[model samples]
Target chain A: MTDKTSAKVWENVPSPFCGIASDDLRIEVCGSSVRVLANGDAVTVPGFERPVTDTAPRIAGEPASLEDAVRRAAEILKEARLPVFSGFGTDVNDTRAALALIDKVRGIFDQARAAGGVRNLLALADSGWIATTLAEVKNRVEVLLVFGSDVEAAFPRFFERFVWNRETLFGQDPARREVICVGRAPSGDAAVSPDGRRPQVVECDPRHLPELAAALSALARGASLQAETVGGIPVVVLRGIVERLRRSSYSVVTWVAGQLDFAHADLTVQQVCQMVALLNKETRAAVLPLGGQDGDRTASQVCAWLTGYPTRVSFARGFPEYDPYLNDASRLLKDGEADALVWVSSLSPAPPPAAEVPTVVIGRSGMQFDEEPEVYIPVGVPGIDHAGHMYRCDNVVAMPLYALRDCGLTTAAAVLAAIEQSL
Target chain B: MTALSFTLKSPLRQRLDASPLVPDRLLGKSPKEIATLDLQYGNRRIAAADLFDIAGDDAESVRISGSPKLDFAGRGMTRGSLIIDGDAGAYVGMHMKGGRLCVSGSAGLYAACELKGGIVEICGNAGDLLGSALPGNKKGMSEGVVIVRGDAGDRVGDHMRRGSILIEGNAGMYLGARMTAGTIAVRGRIGACAGYAMKRGTLLVYGSPVSIGATFNDCGLHTLGFLPLLLKGYQGLNTCFSETRACRSRVRRLVGDLSVQGKGEILLVA
Candidate 1:
């Protein structure tokens, strides 16, 4: 631990926990303890302030050297017929190391957020989508349409940082933007414009979003529907929303994939994307699919660059085979196909899933598991104990992370590389 | 000539890709050569004789005792007959151009996906996206006849260009979605959102659907002259709809999915 007099402040430090990658945080570190002095929210504040409890590697809940733990993990992987690498909640370099290890062991790789990510991926694979980046939304969005999600609840600083900013790159007035919510109401007032204008909320059940999306698409495409009301909302109200979308210079349709919790929810995303595409024929419009928290976007971006597929990849065929359904990590574990599991989550205190097979965990410092894994190696958090790179929710840019403290812990990439060498 | 046979030794720990076992790929090869064929098992390739007990002489007809771990059982076969006696995994008869592929037990996801021309018969229930396109592809089952004797999962005939899918049991949600042209007939109940965003197709439902999308405008009941003709096409297929008594001329015709300006028709048998 460092002396209290050596407390140092870090300015403009980008976050690895929040999906937005908020970069203007001022953090002060002293003796392995961190405090967010400015620009902190519910997500980033807790992320930076979590106590570092575990500092030693263990073999079956008993203290062991890091080398012994890694060797044991490698031995388990070497003897297994099929292994799965899941819960990839680390930075880019660590994820790359994990993928390399999975290929060497002929294992399957999946992320913790793959269930939600796959929903968006299926819609993208079935029918392509027109999407935009955060920079575009911050600069030129005149109208924003949110579907089936409480934006402020999941993303605390989404509106304050992007929607109601003081200024933009262009000369457009940010206070004149229009916010519209459908299916689910916003839990807070963050969506209110700077001029104190409340957003128009179209109240309806989340299950009815599919029909509403379809109706909106039909109306935007100039088709007349015989139904007086669709999904319990008057067609006239939907028409008004469409007219506003048409009249705007630039409009963005956004949604959180995790909030769409119905069967075949990808169809709803597809319908919304189709509506956005149709709106583009007359004016400018695009889609913004949110929810890339827990390093999901980083894992997908890194894996896609290395192997041609995004996630749910298997190297069991001596080549990367992409199957979103067959390669699911949870399904593989439940079906008794995998003989061993290696879970990595260095960003948060998320534990490895309970499995009947032998399991190895390389996770955050304070993760508590219900059942002790075969091997456990506590690692340092990126941006807190070491420098790394992480991808934001938009997936177009990867921001560099700087260390804020001198925590005596190794990085996940180093441990995984050591395990691969032992194999 | 005896039909070729391969019996599984036991349950597999890893999935096996049996794409090379099709008849077109095995013609003129002796039993010794056929036994030496390499199959993908996990990260390595193993000879066919290591896992299966091969026998018989004829290559035109092939029979295999399937496990749930057997995938791509008859992929890209242009001709001949391939039969699976037990459960088959994903991608069964995928990209088949012409032939008869039959499974006596349940089949996994993406069965008959991207099939061009052939007859795929599954005696047990089928998983999701049956007779649909491969991921990122636009067209699915361009020309084929898929008959599922048991219940089928969701998104049946997705983005299909042309084909006929007959489901004897209930069908899950989003039946016949985004089909440009096809005929999907379900004998049992169907889940919500039938004929969603379909540009053109015919969904014949014998049992009441759970829910229909509001976009599908109800056209009332009608006695169509083409109903008998459509039922006659299933005569030699050995399905329950093949019987003459099963032909019902009167149906509640709902034409819509005006969401995509689709001209598809959902015929509910009355």
Candidate 2:
């Protein structure tokens, strides 16, 4: 008797699509599951789906389909001798979410393939000695040098997740690592180390890296010079750097933003490596090469574990073989060398190459290849769509991706397992 | 590049050092001496004969048996088969030109350098910049293919002027930075800035872009002329590229990095 009439009122609440939230325009995102209300009436509908009308804010249409545009993007990157992945669709709605993964992959592929490949992140990860978790970086790593990359732009949460987190490995109390930044412009903005470790910022024009390296090399060997500014660094600061680098037992030299690949990047790395090598003479000196974003380490690890090398592999002979120059996807596409391709996309942002390479999709974005892929499968987003783990740019801390979305999807691991079995 | 073969019987009595400058030092040495030759591993100079029980020598090409882990086995060997069943040590082929160094396993970083022309194949994996120029040098992977069947460490190709780096797996970041001309490809996804400030080169990404530098322009989309033909030979992803009745998407073409007036291009297959 208490709710005989109200029970049916709740029963007829209806699904979001059909039900009216009393506000109609709010439910106009098209594909999103928004609570809907129409003209003082409630309706119930579910399973929102539709064709992409216009990715206006993100991309444009030139009287051509989006697939062609993606292919063209592939061609452009390839001609530029850049690395590209195929996993793009007209789904701008989803791409916004994939920005992080896309940014990571784009940075890594370009950096690794471009001239800046090594100093970008390869050297440190390859050393297998410098990689450390953010917690370790904040709590234990006493000295940290911020090179080219802006952690704010590159990895937004770098400071909060690693340095300033109260419940981190450094405990609830804030204990930060000493920071030193070197760059051509505004190098010290993003992070300066929260702990008493004030960053010694070395600002230089992008071109004067050689002078900087030579000066550092000189100071490293105990040579005294009269120049007040070297590599845009004052002598006083240079001395501090020398002293700090020499004294630190464990330290990481961050190289980002086209350090080695850029014109003077090589000089920068040479200087850093020389310092690390010198420090090795005294104690354990490790340089942490920053891996560009994307699950690059994951891909490298899986591929290396399965094959022998990383990137540009040929399975045409029914056996995997590494061929850097020849098997490079861009070269293969440009020179018409590779007879076929096995495009790999872990829900990265950009689409596959435009060079008509065969492609596959292995991410949870529900994306399909422009060209019908030999195998089209969808995996869940690591942290949101599905739950799994990924390594940070350092390839140090294994961060578990907690599931946030209720997408019924598989993980990269599962897809890899299936692909492996099928192969 | 011409392929040669050599055979070594036993490790040499003294350390056979192949200076990185001379290609003929290791390339011209006889198999009998190469088999027995040895060098200091770290501080202790060991005999090559003791390290690798040599077998199946290909002398004309300087082919050796055992693993690739032998440090400097083919330091600067040109025109040879420096096959290692296992991993190789650092400075494997410092400046090889017109030859092949095939490793069944991984190789230490800085495998090939200042390479004029040659092929360094790793059946397993490789460390940093397998065919790239060393530090304090202008060129990286000048002209050759450094193929790592497995994963390479880092700095696979630091400053490639004209060459290619093909990875079966993913690559470390900053792959083709400042590349004057070359290509760095990964069958899988790549790290960031795969092609940063590239003067003129191609970076083909089968995966997607996790990050796009503020360089590179976005050209209009088109059905690229070369994509389909090349897609035929690939099978890594067991994927195929072509327009079927089910396919209905268009490709985009972007030109210019505008940063350096760079002609570098980046593609994204829709």
Q: Pick the DockQ winner.
A: 1
Candidate 2 regions with alpha-carbon error over 4 angstroms:
A1-132, A141-143, A165-178, A186-189, A192-199, A225-229, A232-236, A247-251, A257-270, A280-285, A316-319, A323-326, A339-341, A358-379, A408-423, B1-270
Q: Lowest-scoring 10 consecutive residues by lDDT in candidate 2 chain B?
A: B237-246
Question: Candidate 1: which pairs clash?
Answer: none
Assess each model's interface with DockQ, reporting 2 decimals per model: 0.65, 0.02
Model 1 misses residue A412 by how many Å?
1.1
- In the range B1-270, model 1's lDDT, one tens digit per residue, is 898999998787788898999999999898889999999886668999999999888889999998888999899999999999998988998999889999999899999998899999999998888888877888988998999999999989988888899999999888988888889999999988888888899999999645688778889999888888888988899997877776865899988788888899899988
lDDT of 1 at A369: 95
Report candidate 2's fraction of native contacts. Answer: 0.00
TM-score of 2: 0.45
| Superposed model 1: Cα runs more than 4 Å off | A1-5
